[model samples]
Every structure is written in structure tokens, then in C-alpha cells.
Target: MRFFCIALAAASCAFADGVGIAFPQENALLPAVKRTYVIGAIPAADATQPLTIAGVTNDVYKTGAFIAMVPVEGGTNTITLTWGTNTLDRTFRVAFPSPPKPAATNTPPRDVRKDLGIPPDEEVSDARPKGKRIEDLTVMIDPGHGGQDTGALMPHGAGEKTVNLLQAQAIEAEFAKYGIKTVMTRTTDDEFPALYARPRRAYAEKVDAFISVHHNSTAADRDPREVRHTAAYASTPNGLALAKAIQQYVGPQVTGVKNAGAQMRSYAVCRNPAVASCLLEIDFINLPEGEDAALNDADRRSRIAHAVLIGFLDWLFAPDDGT
Candidate 1:
């Protein structure tokens, strides 16, 4: 495969590798994220043959193959991929923008994809045949709470909704660079989605993956049972894997991210098997600090989005971490 190699030595030497897998500003995958990246080396003489990568499909990658990743949709996922004895023995994460919320459409459209220097457009038909494209995928980002329902007020005066939308837009930019299709749950700052309607949209869109993005609140009035580390919930076996991927990937990338792990909830949106579903409760929005940080800064936000992307890719093309 002709990868748009990022020329590792060429990227602007970046900050300390504080986050998950660190890359200089020019990793090939980051730049041409929309298209698959074939990150491989000639199998070492000792390397295993018919090398297999199994995390995502629970199957194997053909022999003498390079790893491929598609970063169109944003969400964390876990999968086990192996390539013989000489394998990609590690967890890989692709940075994707966050799911959209009801108010983001109006947040001053910014071309995040451009800022990131992601790959340019070269249209190609989705490899997925028709109906299976049901799994073909469309991301429905739901940034919980809006005009009336304050998702969780951040300390520095940022609203959870704002953070959700901002992150969603960022994720969208990443997806666009790869030519992935997407649908936002909302684009305005005016109304709140009905509690029930939020998940309903994914079902209607036939979204292959559904994600609800919202920061939690420590509201005394809010459910006291809500405070926890980074939490995710899913609907099926695949969904559980996805949640595990996110939790595992995000913890390494974000400084304060706590692993809430995966659980099956009775959420209406998560129950549908047609699409893989997850709700990411990122930190306590009610905390004055989380609120401020979720917004205001671009780099931190970038890390969050990147973590999700990496987690999703890890799940989709999960690397074999020799247990």
C-alpha cells in the first residue's frame, strides 16, 4: 500500500510523550488519517509468518502484511491482533474528534481537519458492500444537555455541552480527512434533545456506531451516584470490546482520565444491536477545574480527541499485545 508516510523524523519534535502512544507532529497516520495507514516493517528474519492481527475481527491479518487503520469515526475500542511471534505487540490508538452535541453546529465552523494537516480528498467507494454498510457506519455524536439542560457546568465557566460539541467537531474534522460519513445529533445552541430522543436518532440514522458525549456533573441535585472516572457503557459483545478499548487507550493518554470500564446499561440508545453504542462520561463537569479545561485550551482538547481516535483504531485494528 502507498501510505502517505508521515516521515517520523520530519514532524516538529513535539512535547514530552505524556499522552498515549506519542508521535512527532508528522506521523504518517495522523496526517493521512482518513485513509488506511500501512505501518509495517519487513518481517524480521525471526518474525513469524502468515502473521495475523486479530483484535478487531477476532480473526487474523494475512501473512507478510502491514497494519491498516481507518480513523473516520471517533470512539474507543479494544481488540486483540497478533502477527506471529514477531508481532505488533502493543495497543494503538487513533485520535478522532468527539461526538457532536445539539449546540455545536453553531459554534463557529472551524476547519480542524485543515489545522491538523490531515490527508486531502481522493474519493473512493467504501469497501463495504451495500447493506452491510449498515455496519458501514455513520457517527451520531450526542453531546448530552443543551440550552436548558446544563450537562455539567465546568469550573472555568465552560458548559459540558460546549465541550461536547467542540470535541465532536474536532472528531468530524478527522473523519472528513478520511472521507467518512457522519451526522451530528444537533448543530444549534438553542434546544435540549428529549432525554429519549437523543438515542433515537442513532436508530433513525442507521448509524453503525453511536456515541453520546457528555461530561458528568457533581451537581448536588444531579444523581449522586454519577461521580466516577472516565466511564463508558455499551450494548453488545462487540460494544463491550469497544468500551474496553476506549478505557484502556484513554487512561494512558489523558492525565486525569479514570477508568470506569464498561457495563451494559438500560439506556434506550445502547440496546439496539444494529449499531454499536457507547456513552463516555468524561470527568466531573461540576468540578470547577474540569469545566474550564474541557474548553479554553486546544492542545488538551486535541489529546482527548486523539485518545478517542486511537482507542477506536486500536479496537478496529487491534494490535496483539502478547499477554
Candidate 2:
């Protein structure tokens, strides 16, 4: 398989002693269960060496093939394999499905797909064949705020929540063209999940990436029209790659959109340690020009979304650990 071939090639550069990862392959996405195991092999001559994984050294086999079980954490988990003087590590995500929340007054949860003008039947369509790069990858798209949370409103009363949803839908459609599956936190203007639930939903889906779409706003006391910058935030290094990709690929596509650049922030959506995530402020909607471009222009929204798509592709194909 391609995964094994790539993994073997990676193992080769790190060691010439015939050490390799045989199972759970590299960059494997595992279920978010309580415990999981990793399997790999080393030279039979060196099988007697004590091997440690994620700090657990017991249960490691001495028959060349080594297997160790470790506890799973929500979001992303890095498993480190160390033996003798060499060490190898792989990063993977563990996403447990979100448990059903009790319905208020016995009412079922709202189905926002229909409200968002998306036919429920069209939610999962396999007619569009998957692309090789994004196949088996999932991205959770969170539209910043909804319902009562209007977010940053323009002077003309244009709501930031609406613009966020519009841009998210456009981005989701672009990702769809590449056969990538996407999950949305809120599909309609009326739907509103709690602030913390946004990223939590991404973790539950074990999504490969999490992106929160929002428009920036300045203090009400200051002129909102003065800000006209595009900013992206990330917490992890991999997340930063995603952030920078957007800044590099999408920032220039929008008129008057200055690349404020990608930054590190503790925002709730991308703050999870396990998920590679980014939060994008395409433009400051409070600025008249920014609002017109980001909120009203369909072509501009599409271009920005396309740029983000390109950025993600760049990150996925980038070299890993100098490999």
C-alpha cells in the first residue's frame, strides 16, 4: 500500500538498522476509544533492547515485532517509539463520536440542513468520486456564530453571522469539488451551538482539520472601517501550516484584503491539541469595503474559498520531518 511504502521510506532515513513501522502505519487515524495499540518491528539482533512507547515500556515483544498499548486522548495524540539510541514518533487523531445531548422539553434536536436550504437527502452523496489527496480526510467547518449571536455587525446592520455562514458554505462546496467530506457545526442562521461545543464537535468527528470562519471586528468605540486585514490563528505547528497556507494562498485573492498573517491564539475552535485546526478572519466586516467584498460579493467569496482549498492542498503535500 502507499501508506506502508511511504512509512518504510521514512523509517529508512532515520535508521539504517532495519527498524520499521509495520502496523498502525504512519499518520494513522484511530478511533477515539479508551486504549489502542501500536505495532512495529526492529532488527531481530536488536530485539532484546528495551522499547518504550508513549512512556509505557511493558508488553513490548522481543520477537522483532513490537506492540504496545497506550491510553487514548480526545483530539490528537502523539505516539513516540524509542529503543536503544533511536526513536520514532507518529502523530494521529482519536475522535470519539459526540454523545447525544438530552433534548430540551423532549423536543428533538433541530435539523439545520433543511433550514440551510440543503436537501437532507443530499447530505451524503458518493456520486462524486473521492480525490486521492483528500480521500478519507474530513474537515469540520464551524461558522463562527449564529442565532442570537450576531457576532460583529456592520454599520448597515449586516450581520457577521450571515457572512460567516455564506463563506463557510462556499468553502465547503469548493472542498466538495475535490471529493473531500466536510461537517458543519451550524448549517443555518437559526442554529447555534455553544461556544465550547464547536471544537468539541470537530473532535467527536475525528476530523483531519478544523476551520472556523469569522469576520474580524474592532472595538465599537473605534471606527470599524479602519480595520482591513485578514488574519488566521492556530495553536499547533501543523495548525500553523494550515493558517499560513490560507494567508499565502487566499489573502491576495481578495481586494483590499491585507495579509495580517497567521498567528498563534487560544481560540476555542483551534485550541484542541489533537486536531490540526485554523480560524480564519477573511476580512474585517466592519470596514465598509471589507463588508462589501466579504459579505456581498459572491465572486469574492468563491475566490477566497478556492484559495483556502489550495492552501490545504499545499499543507497535505508538504514534506514531513524533512522526509
Q: How many clashes (backbone N, Cα, C below 3 Å) per candidate?
A: 29, 1
How many Å off is the CA of 238 in candidate 1?
3.1
Q: Which one wins on TM-score?
A: 2
Runs of candidate 2 exceeding 4 Å displacement: 1-133, 321-323
Model 1 agreement with the true structure over 100-175: per-residue lDDT tens digits: 5566456774332233232346231111122333235566677766787756544233357788887677766666
Best-fitting candidate, scored by lDDT:
2
Q: Estimate each model's TM-score.
A: 0.52, 0.57
Q: lDDT of model 2 at residue 292? A: 56
Model 2, residue 96: C-alpha shift (Å): 49
The superposed Cα distance between candidate 2 and the true structure at residue 102, in angstroms, equals 40
lDDT of 2 by residue, 199-297 (tens): 666655657788899998764234443456788998667678778877787665564567888988877666655567899988876544555577668
